[model samples]
Target: MAYSADGTRLFSCGTSKDGESYIVEWNESEGAVKRTYQGFHKRSLGVVQFDTTKNRYLAAGDDFSIKFWDMDNVQLLTAIDGDGGLQASPRIRFNKEGSLLAVSGNENVIKVMANSDGLRLLHTFENVSSESSKPAINSLAAAAAATSAAADRSANVVSIQAMNGDARNMVDVKPVITEESNDKSKIWKLTEVSEPSQCRSLRLPENLRVAKISRLIFTNSGNAILALASNAIHLLWKWQRNERNATGKATASLPPQQWQPASGILMTNDAAENNPEEAVPCFALSKNDSYVMSASGGKISLFNMMTFKTMATFMPPPPAATFLAFHPQDNNIIAIGMDDSTIQIYNVRVDEVKSKLKGHSKRITGLAFSNVLNVLVSSGADAQLCVWNTDGWEKQRSKVLPLPQGRPNTAPSDTRVQFHQDQAHFLVVHETQLAIYETTKLECMKQWPVRESSAPITHATFSCDSQLVYASFMDATICVFSSANLRLRCRVNPSAYLPASLSNSNVHPLVIAAHPQEPNMFAVGLSDGGVHIFEPVESEGKWGVAPPAENGSANGAVATPSVGASASEQPQR
Candidate 1:
């Protein structure tokens, strides 16, 4: 159930015993039905969710069709097309901002539709390619020119679209600079990666027919894109946005598509014949970007960035830690909030639990720490926010932030964030308002109430410089606020505002982290196991593309092949 501002009404959408879907509104006080929107969807899956950005609920069913219901009055707004033909369950997801809805299933195509600004086609990818293509489209030509002189040279341009609807190229583009002499036109090179016989205009790989992409997350800086499948995660793909007219487009060459057997924070079992447990639920990169930590099936494991080896493992806890975060100062220090309403601080240096922190009255949902003050803050389902000063693991200080006089009829959705270096100012999102406070003074600074009558904030974070505060609601809008004055900065659609490769209807970011070194760089982790990194416009006053990491992954292996390997063995662009 969801609540309206002032907690006067509650909203919920569920399937009745007769297998019919409905949106029921109730009075917050007496639990009386205030209103009901019938015919939510046929054969519904009972997993409907609210998107605060759009201020509505997303209802889907086994039929593959998704209906968007307006929350202002709980009415069927629009029904987007789905991929499920008749018997398949619907797989509809709203992008972070509700701008695009991605639907995929038994069909070879993953359809993405731009719902706002007039419905339009965003992209379409083939499910599987029977044969790869020849010397892939290597580059993109400059934008079409208006004059004949420019058209003469720029006629060879081609745009590279991926099978999964990743709008950008799968690899980097190498730009070719030439003189303005002979009617110079920008000629793009499109290099196809898949083999010739299997190339299809819109299909992905046949391997994906049975392989489920459990996660597709972006890095904190928004430069790298990560995808997790049944066997392994395709990590660290870089995208270069060109501005100069003469710059050439180049993409990194990749090896042939095949499954490998390995298991790490980014690895999965590729052999479909072998039954595997569900993929890991949570994954996080360290502040130093040196390791990837993941929690699954009650196990917490850390993998090395360079070797992808299991660096360490903590004591097995009772429940899985769905949310994990690395310490700001020490990569060895990790904070984990579990479904059990407890926070465990693990000391990687000794590979043991240094201390267990607890205070939340309900299950802990989010966790954050401040390096400047060496403190940890957590919020949870219990409707309470708690702060702890980390001295050693076993001994520390603790305090509970004040809350409203009484618990609202329902618990607020899980979302919280601590300010930048200054832990003094933090943001706690309640069902109706975003409360600002100074940790040191232990006083509420101000509250920004959502008068638009949207759902409560689901995800919130502060910029590296503490200049902006962003919060995402069930309405599908990310409301940005100014840290200096607590004023509304702006509301942005994650799909419209986020990097192209990271945009997807099924991708909903649950965690946001700022880059420790770069002021404007940040990374977000999604429920689909996707991570995206975004950088401000003027990083270092120069738009420098992120160089690929020299790890032993596919790209890294090609960059530094083993001895006795012929130079021709290197991946070709």
Candidate 2:
């Protein structure tokens, strides 16, 4: 069941008592049936959804076919046969704009269709099963059963239930039956019976099992799609838009939009067994888009983005590598945060670790490098922040920040520390609060409570113009804040990009990487292992507003310094 966009009407579908399936529309305010459409599906109804966009249509999927109806007149528009086998209860969802629909069921296929023009078949994604060994095991079991039956005596067959039920009520005597001998005068007694049990055993493969998409959603822009399976999330970018006909209507001849898989997150049971609380795999693209750094299993893989080839691999000692960052101006220099509360500085060109900075007593959680200030900052589980002078490759300062009271002391709650694109300011996010600091002063300028819940902040970044700060939380929201006064700007609920039902499911943003050049464009990495590049539609006068005076204090303002300042100068207190 679903409510219409205006909340004036309601739509629902189900099988009737007489075995007939139907879709009914109801007036929400009056609680009266507005219209009833019946006899559209031969079998039981699977799913029903109302298009909320200008294309006011209703879609219903059943065992064998999907039917489209015009919501205004209650007329059948068209019906498409299911390409795969029976889909008794297929999961269906519409994109945010109601332009496309996705359908999936027990089969290894997901069908994408156009909703505007007669429900045309757009694309079919097949062989998306999570467990590859299931098919082979089924075939092997069938073959084993076929061969095992041939060795059993047909006449000696007896139902186990019949024997067990009646034998307990009978006397302890064996009944005898006679078979005629060749002479006809003599007879042979046959009283013995034999039963053979069939034994079949199968050994499951030890490798990682493939998972099918159990849930799917589109970003609000409809430019990205996310597929969530068992322990992995697959992310794809819509490479093209649907073409329109001469009359400005979407046509069937237009080929399906191309989708490119950007990245995937795979968290297997084994990886979880090792730590039970393993962090999700994360990737970060360099400022120039030349190198891509990915962290998995305590190893960092460096890849050339243009060629998509592995350039080098760096393995940290003891604990796993959790976070990574590249120097804004020099891609060759990479900073890695390790599980053992140490930061390793590596020169990718030389393929060697240049230095290790240790200050925190717990695992390192965040790392960031500022090209303008030539400084590196790191945070760890011990609630301590360590600042390093990149010029001399030495630790400059260490500060122990107060941790939130009554929280467990297992892992570091700090998630990020990032420099603004303009190099004027930096942000340190710990627990639910974000602290903004000036580069020259290195003092906390403004502290804002970023989230209402205790969910830790996962990622934070400044817009390319350095006027706004974007922070993502574990509660599946990206909060936008004004850089000057740290005032709340807006909250972006990514789930709003999905269908109403699926939006309620648990999906959190894990990693966020800003685009090098575009201020409004950035890539968001989800907990399911999906990386989506978001280019939101701009509204009028929405960008770069000055912070409110009531929220900004006099001490929070810092003057920008000239580029020629000496590195040996002490930072202003």
Candidate 3:
């Protein structure tokens, strides 16, 4: 079941005992069926979702096809039957703004469709699971064969030479004969290996053949999609908008047949469990959409999104990685804060631990790497903050920032550390207050008290020019501050821009990412899985705020002072 953007309608799909599947729309408040779109799928219906963007359509999938329905009129808008056969209920997810829809199931392929172009197939990813497995399997086979042959030949020749006089001379003669015999046996082995192929066929493992997609999620920026399958997590990107058809309508055209594996992380233990019903392992994407993270059996793995390379694997004692941070300037360096009260500085290029920092006695809660100051800071539950110099990968300073007056025994909440983009200062945000520190002296410059609220501040980032800072409170409000004096510039509530149905929901902001190049532009991800891109509009020396646009675009019009425009102006998203 899925709720509409405004929460007024609910879309659901289910199969009856007789194998008939149906999709229905319900009026949430009245508890009545608004519309019933029946007999759309021949087999059991497995997936149903509502497109919350301007498209306002409902997509359902079954064994044979995927169907899209207009939410307002209950009309069958389009049905796509070219998906071949979905092994299980197809998993469908929309991009942050609902412009692109990604569908995957038992098959090893993910189909990306464009909503603006009548749900046309924009890109297809094939062999998402087997691409990496193939090479690993072949290498394992070659290594095993080499080891077995070497061991067997060594034993056989030793026995043969042992029975003769002067065993050393016999051993030398055995090699000459074995060399000749090897040449003859090579052809026999090749022919023997191929003989069965002429009469029989090779079959793939059942699990590999039916590796179904268990989870699908889009990054906050809508630049990539994370598909969690049975044995691995697949990162997919390279999205191209659909071309306009002859009728002047955007439609799916044949996309370039070229598709590359963005990156794949192996879940060896999870796959070895061999349970088809088990859930996919837990994984996360970094706030900036630059790194992919996954944890299994107390080990954390990081992958570079751009190159699709495994950046590093960290095995910290006792506690696992609870927080991660990538260096803004040097992608090769990453800081991982573990629950064990230690921070691991990893050099991704060599896949080695550059340093292990220890200062706090309890778990580490937050980590931040400053590009301008070349410093790494970590916060811990032990009421301590540790600062490290990135140049030497050594701890430079440590400060005991204890919990507030009465909350000393409470479990430490997440600590947000951010550096101003202009390299002037940095901020450390704790439970109910934040402190600004000068970059040069690393001295506390000013301390600002955060408004008391049930929801804490989930994210805080400085603007590019270092003039303004934006902090997102879980209460669905973003507080802007003047960087110099930490003065409250304004507080903007994102709920006002959300649909009416979602206003009542606890749709609080989870993350806020500022653009690296554009100071006025930033992105906010909500707890309800929605990403909003905002850009402060500059007009007549005043900042004009505009309504949030689909796909984060401003639509070429700006409103009066409020916040910013949309993600359309930022290059990263």
Candidate 4:
């Protein structure tokens, strides 16, 4: 419905009473329809900016050619007759300067057209991977010149090149961190700047398929790309190369000559080449990037970043497995959370289950190991809380922190208890109250009532130094509060970030996790199979937030904003 350019403009296309299809543009400024153009041979699938500089638009769909339109007049400018280019509806987007428009569809090739009069085929990049029966390019973005903001020093917009297989086939869609997804192409970014004609090829492993990319995050360092897929998470690290004589005022023509090969790093449970069942539902890496803890179907897996292989699997007791966690120390010691409302301590180095502790009446939803004392604290859906000795889980100290009593069967959500960095206090976010408790005395320190419109606190995470606590609301909003007083600090509403398919579900925030290093950055996963990433900004003496959902909507009609390296990169699949 809206695409972010300056703000957002609503776009639509449909048939007129005369049976001919018409393209209409709405001016958000005036809140009215601006103009209409009716020149497409068939129904227009969608409209994308054809020339970013001129603020022009392109309309295409059933026709064999992409129609260019002057946005000011909504008049047909020209149509590039791609007799074979528009077999399937292609998603199109123009680069920052509107110099290049990348289009990809049902075909195996991703075509880049120069925004000249003839719509010149500046480049045609194809997926050479043998795993693909037919390489389908899901999306594409043009690499920015990387020189826009000299002082701030951000790389050019990283284009996200994604793909997937044709629907109707049964493929591996497990939410694991993998290179590709089942029946869909995994999302990847072009590390270098825009080289419209460059066609570097890659070979991908067979049988790996990417369904749809949920989110793509490019690290501030420009050395890594984090891709959240339907079933898994993937990390792509750039292989660094020393710049020989690089100087300032770089030209856009030198992206290809400056970079080296990139490598993929994954912490997956299904590391066995032949195992088909192991997977990674979601995962988080430490600030140091030395450790990665992942949640599989019924187990927690740990991995060493250097080798990219599983070091241990922390499975719960027999027939009651669910989640696991590794202490911040990255020792072989692991904490296991069970579906049967129990916490188990394991000495991974010794390959032994240390102890099983009884605590809550409901399933354990969250577990954290304090770095100060190496103590393990667990929270349950039953609104119960407890702490355990690092040496043994049997040394359980249960504390019934004060909570607003709710009706039976309506208990608090999981992972709402967030321990502060001091390790002396923690915050308990319940359906009706945000309670802060002192760990030493197990006493309620403070409490803040939740606004009626805000969803119950299902998940919460503390900032690095424990200055602030970010909580995800059921109403698709993330509220921030000062850890000192539990006072409201800021809020980010991701209601607009959801894909159209999931937007209407109004599901609770199923998973809320933040990057350990990027304190202002976090991700929210919804029940409707959509994951949204958000980052903080300080524009005018105040903080603001932005979502990665730019063009991503429902029905393959929306698009995610390509702000980072993940936007322009292409994976081997």
Q: For model 2, how does the per-residue alpha-carbon lDDT over 33-53 read when each residue is reduced to its tens digit?
A: 689874465645433333333
Error of 1 at 477 (Å): 2.2
| Global Cα RMSD, each model | 26.3, 29.8, 29.3, 25.5
Per-residue lDDT for 118-205 in model 4, tens only?
A: 1222212112222234323211101111111211232312221111111111011111222223222223211121221221111112
Pick the TM-score winner.
Answer: 2
**Of models 1 and 2, which has the larger lDDT?**
2
- lDDT values of the candidates? 0.45, 0.50, 0.50, 0.47
Prediction 2 global C-alpha lDDT: 0.50
- Each prediction's TM-score versus the true structure: 0.45, 0.48, 0.45, 0.47
Q: At residue 405, what lDDT does model 1 achieve? A: 51
Q: Which stretches of candidate 4 lie over 4 Å from their true place?
A: 1-288, 304-308, 311-317, 391-396, 401-406, 409-412, 451-454, 495-509, 517-519, 528-531, 541-573
Candidate 3 residue runs with Cα over 4 Å from true position? 1-298, 304-318, 326-331, 370-374, 391-393, 439-441, 453-455, 536-573
- For model 3, what is the alpha-carbon lDDT of residue 344? 79
